[model samples]
Target: MNDLEDLPEKNKIFESDIFIKILTSPREAFKFINDYNYEKHLYILLFLAGMLRSFDRASTKNMGDNYSIWAIILISIIFGGLFGWITYYIYSALISWSGSWLNGKGNTESILRILAYALFPSILSLIILIPQIAIYGETMFKSENDFYSSGLVESVIYYGFFIIELILGIWSFVLCVIGISEVQKLSIGKSILNLLLPAILLIFFILILVLLFKLIN
Candidate 1:
C-alpha cells in the first residue's frame, strides 16, 4: 500500500508520446515527428522541389556555356509539380494502408476525409511550380538546342531518379506506418512530407558534391 502511494500517478507517468515510444520501436525517428505537424509536409514539398531543382541546375551548369540561370529555374518549377503529384499519390496510398486517424480525432470517417483532402496541397502547389518551370524551360530551350536534343538522355536520368525517389519515399512511408501504430496521433501532413525529404540530399547534395570534387581535381 505504501509503495503504491510512493509511486507517481499513473496519468502523470505517461507523457504525450511516451506511450507512443513504448508501443513502437525505432523510437528516435518517431519522437521528433510529433512536433511541427503541418510544417513537416511543407518541408517535404519544398525539399522535393529543392532536390529536383538543384539537380537540374547542376546538370545545366555542367553543360558549359549553354547554362542559363533563367532556364534552370523555369525547368525546376515544372519538375517540382511532377514530383509533388507523385508525392501525393504515394503518401495517400501508404497512409491509408496504415489505418491513420487525423486531427487528434480517431475515427474511420476522419481517416477517409484526410485522404480526400490531400489533393488540395498537391494541385494547389502546382499553380506556382508549373509557372516557374515554364519560365526556365523557355530560357533553356532558347539558349541551347542541346537541352532539347539531349531530351532522351535527360528523361532516362530523370526517370532513374524518380524511381529512386519513389523507393525511398515508400520506405519512409512505412516508417510512418510504424510511427502511427504507436503514436496514433501521427500527423498526416508531416508523414506525407517525411516521405520525400531524403531525396533533397540524395539527388542534389551527393550529386553536386561529386561534381565539385571533380572540378577541383
Candidate 2:
C-alpha cells in the first residue's frame, strides 16, 4: 500500500506540467528540470527542432523540380534528427566549457537538459509549417515561386504565420538564455554573454584560419 502511494511521487518526475511551466515561469521550470533530471522526450524535442530548422534552410534554397514534398520532408527528418543530436552535444559541450571560464556551475548534461526544454517554443512553431505546406506544396521550397504575388489573402496569411514563427523562434532563444542562467547560476546579462562566447570564438578562429590560408596562397 505504501509502495503504491509512493509510485505517483516517483513517477511525477515525468509530469507534463513542466511544458506549461517552462513557458510561464522558465527559471523555476529549468531549476526543477535540472534538479530532477527530467529527460523524457529530450531526443524527440531536439529532433523536431532540428527538422524545423532544416526545413527552414531548405525553404530558402532552390530544391529544384525533381524533388517531391514528401521526399524533402523525409530527408529533413533523417538528416535533421542526426544534425540535431550532433549539434546538441557539441553546443552543450562548448557552453559547459566556456561557462567554466566565468565560474559557472553547470556541467554538459545539465546544460543539455535545459537546452532541450528550452526548445519547446520551437517545437510548437512546427504547427505553422503544416498550413504553409498545405497551401504552397512544393512551391514553398522553390525560390522561383514568388509567394507574395499570389494574392492579398494568401500573402496576408503567409506573412501572419511567418510573424508568429518569428516570435516563437525569438522566444525560444529567450528561454534558452533564462535556462542557461539558471543552470550556470549567472545573471541574465552574463548568461547572454556565455551563450555568445562559443559563436564569438568560432568566428575568431575562422577569421584566423582565413588569414593563414591567404598567407599560404
Candidate 3:
C-alpha cells in the first residue's frame, strides 16, 4: 500500500504460493501496472505458474487421475505456459469485480496469452512424452516409479525442473523490479539483488542435492 521500500523486510515478494501472494494484495499488485508495460506482471504470473507446475509435477505424482497420470504432466505443461499471462486478466477481473466474466468470460488478450503459453508447451510436452510413453508405453508416473517413475535419477531431474521454474519466477521478479524501479527511478543495484536471490537459493538447493545423493547411495 506504501512505497516498495516502506514494505517490511519480510514482505517477501517471492513466495511459496504465488497465487496467494499476487491475489492477496490485488490492488497493490495492480498498481504496479503502467501504460507502456502492462505485460510485465504477466511474466510474473507465468513464472508463478511455472513454479506451481514444477512442484506439482515433481512432488504430487501420487494424486489425481494417476491412472492416466501422463495427463498430469500434459496439464502441468499447459498451466506453466498459460497461467503466467492468463493470471493478469484474472487479477484484473477480480479487481474490477466483474462477477459475470467467469461464465464464459474471455478477453482477446487473455485468450491469446493462454493459447500461446498453453499450446506451445503442451505441444512440446506431448512431443517429448510421446516418445517416452511409446518406449515405456503403458507405464505412468508414480511416486515410487523408479527413473521412469521415480528414483535418485528422477529426483535430480525433478530438482532440475524445480530450479528452472524458480529461475523463471526470479527472472520475472527482476523484470518487475527493473521496470517499476526505472519508471519510479529507483536503484538498479536493488533490482539486481532481487534477481540474485534465486542464485543463492539455487546454491543452497544444489548442496542439499549433493548431500542427498551421498546419503542415498
Candidate 4:
C-alpha cells in the first residue's frame, strides 16, 4: 500500500497510516513522512519513548525500603525525558554530520524525523517489563535471591525477555539505517558508515582521553 496516499490530514498525524507504516516499512514510511508534514509527531514520539524507558527502569528498582514508587516514577519521567531529548539531538546531529561528509545533502529536520521514528522498536521494549515485574517483584534488582532465586528454567525464561529486549534494540538500529538512508539520500553502505562513524569516533576519543590521563598521572 502507498502509505502516503492514505496519510492522515494535518490535524490528525497520529491517525495516519503513515504512522503505523513507520514500524512495518520505515524506508517507504520515512519517504512519505518526510515529504509531508509531521513535525508534531516528533515530540510526541520522543515523549512516549521516554515513558517506556522510565517504565523499564522502574521495573528494575526496589521500591520497598527507601525508594518510593512515586519518586521512581518522577525520576524516570525527568531523567528519561531529558536523556531521550538529548539523545534525539545527538543522533540527529551525528547523522547530519556524517551525511555532510558523504556528499549527502540533508538537514536536521529529516535526520530528526528518521531518528525519532527509529525509536519505535525500542518503545516495543516495554513489553519485556511484564515478565520482569513478575520475576523481580517490587524489590531491588540486586537482591534477586530474596525474591525468586534463579533455577535453570526460571533463569532461561527470565533472561529470555532481556534477550528479546536486546533484539528489539538492534531492530531499532536496523530501522534507523533504513530511515536515515532514505531521508538523507545515502546508499546502504554510506548509511551504515553514517551510523557507525559516530561510535567509532567516540571510542577513539575516549581512548585518547585515557591515554592522556595515564600520561598525566
Q: Output the number of the lDDT-best candidate.
A: 2
TM-score of 4: 0.76
* Model 1, C-alpha of 158: deviation from truth (Å): 2.1
Candidate with better lDDT, 3 vs 4: 4
* Tens-digit per-residue lDDT, 1-217, candidate 2: 1232343663465355778888898887887777767677788888887888788778876663658899888878899876856787889999999999998899998899899889899888788888888888889888688777878898898889889998998999999999999999999999999999999999999999999999999
For residue 38, model 3's alpha carbon misses the true position, in angstroms, by 7.6
**Which residue pairs in model 3 clash with each other?**
45-84, 46-84, 145-150, 146-150
lDDT of each: 0.42, 0.84, 0.43, 0.72
Per TM-score, what order, best first? 2, 4, 3, 1
Candidate 3's C-alpha runs over 4 A off are 1-67, 73-86, 92-154, 180-217
- For model 1, residues 1-217, the per-residue Cα lDDT tens digits are 1232343565234334332432354344333333212122434444454444444444545532454655555455556544544554454344444433333322332232232222222223334445434534444324243444557867565455446545544544455444543344645565544334444435788889999999999
Local accuracy of candidate 3 as per-residue lDDT tens digits, 161-197: 5465455555445444443333333355643443244
Off by over 4 Å in 2: 1-14, 64-66
Instruction: Give one digit per residue, the lDDT tens place, for model 4 in 81-164.
Output: 767676667767877886789987667777887777888788777666656655664553332444256677877876787788
lDDT of 1 at 72: 52
TM-score of each: 0.28, 0.90, 0.32, 0.76
| lDDT for 84 (candidate 3) | 43
Residue 85 lDDT (model 4): 70
